[model samples]
Target: MKYIKGIFWLMAIACVIYAGYTLHSCRQRLANNPMGLELGFQKEINQTPVVLQSIERIGQWEFLSIDDEVMVDTTESHLLSPDDHLVRIYHGTLRLGIDFSLCDRGWATASGDTVSLRLPPIQLLDRNFIDEARTRSFYEYGTWNVQAKEDMYNRARTRMIQRAMTPQNIKQAEDNARHQVEALFRSLGYRVVRITVGRSS
Candidate 1:
């Protein structure tokens, strides 16, 4: 009876140790996650407009004439150095019109309208550097030892999930992209700008 009791105590102690070890391993795995993954900006410039207007008064006859607005639309390609990221800008055409109204108080109202100034789809400026960095990091630290291979794998996977799929990481990437666009627009004289990001994969 005493022997059986001792055996029972031994088994309980072993189970407790195993459980503690597993919890400690899991905690350690959670600590090795890397943070921050962001790509550069991919910008597309659409159209630039130039307007010409003329007004003249001759022999008591008032005349106002305006030429069609000119638009320079061209694709501009930019490549980021060191990262070899590619960004293409597709330019669109601009449309210009005018509205004129006559008033009873010897006054007139004239307004110019400009339309069709838009941007093309901005694709990933570059992802080669990001891919290479991830690959190298994985190869360097994702190796395994025969004795602890399984533990290492579990830890690595946990770390990858924590690093790659964390809500904070997603938010950071989106914020970075939005800031890039905001800055681009600001440079082009957009004083009040709003940025919105959709869900990413």
Candidate 2:
């Protein structure tokens, strides 16, 4: 019975010594590095301006696309010969949106969970929208020269632009851009996003 009791006492002392050594080591580490027990949350955000910078790196952001078809006909008359008539149908796609390259340094600002952005005005993304390969000669009479066909193509392109690039279409594209931008910011942890569409100074 005495031997068992002695063994138990030795085990207890060993446990106490181990606990004391652990506590002392912990104290020493804390003394050397005072912020070991920091319980506060880190509230500073580092991705505030990175969002805009990333967007600026995207060269052309297309928000809207309009498909248009235009028919143009031209006729050349000669007194001694029959009139040469050429009718063509042109297909084009008009892409409209903000050019991120135009975004200024002060385009985006963030405060807490709120982000404000000043984006460049939405405009036609590409002027050469016509698909020349898709141009179909609807009707042709007699032989047409290259210049005549070129003139008809120009007229067709102009008509398509006029028909597709209206004020209503532009407004729709702007609205879409706002929604897209808001969604992007919200996904990036921004709760409130304010966007303004205008020419950046």
Candidate 3:
């Protein structure tokens, strides 16, 4: 039992000494090399997937606005009042941008020092564009029903979207997206970046 224990301890000491020597040799060779790469080649690290996952919406534009007036006539008798109507001005702002969440497949690729990026289509970012509480009542001669006000809000929202989402605006957004993404790729050591934009983008 005593001899077995002694041999075990000697083997353990030899292993420790061999490990220290190996570590020292590795450090000395690394010190002699400028890049310290053991194989003299570094694996190309593709970060497109990671970047796409981290990104959400990009190229947000919200400058266009519309002032829509909704007029509602009263159903009451004409003898009681000469003219009864509700007039409200809906001030709505249209915001459009690219949704990166939809960029699930074939959005980006990288080969050598070149990167190819495809941006998603531009769309309305917000659902509730019109703030009814913020709507100003230009003139109100009678009480307006809830359904009429809701319909007016919907109409205003549709008109604002239609007027704002133009081909020129979509192209501008795509251009902005390309610039931003190219800069990002350049920062990541990419020499050339190619951008692909679809119809809606």
By TM-score, who's the top model here?
A: 2
Best by lDDT: 2
**For model 2, how does the per-residue alpha-carbon lDDT over 133-171 read when each residue is reduced to its tens digit?**
898989999998888888887887788777777888888
Off by over 4 Å in 3: 1-80
Model 3 has an lDDT value of 0.69
Per-model lDDT: 0.38, 0.87, 0.69
> Model 1's lDDT to the true fold?
0.38
lDDT string, candidate 1, 1-201, tens digits:
999999999999999999999989877776787643459886866688967687654221111111111111122234663321222121211111111221123222222321112222222221111221222111222223444433433344444333444555445545555566557666766665554333433
**What is the lDDT, from 0 to 100, of the residue 165 in candidate 1?**
42
Superior by TM-score: candidate 2 or candidate 3: 2
Error of 1 at 24 (Å): 62
Roughly what TM-score does model 1 have, to 2 decimal places? 0.24
What shift in Å separates residue 157 of candidate 2 from its native position after superposition?
Answer: 1.6
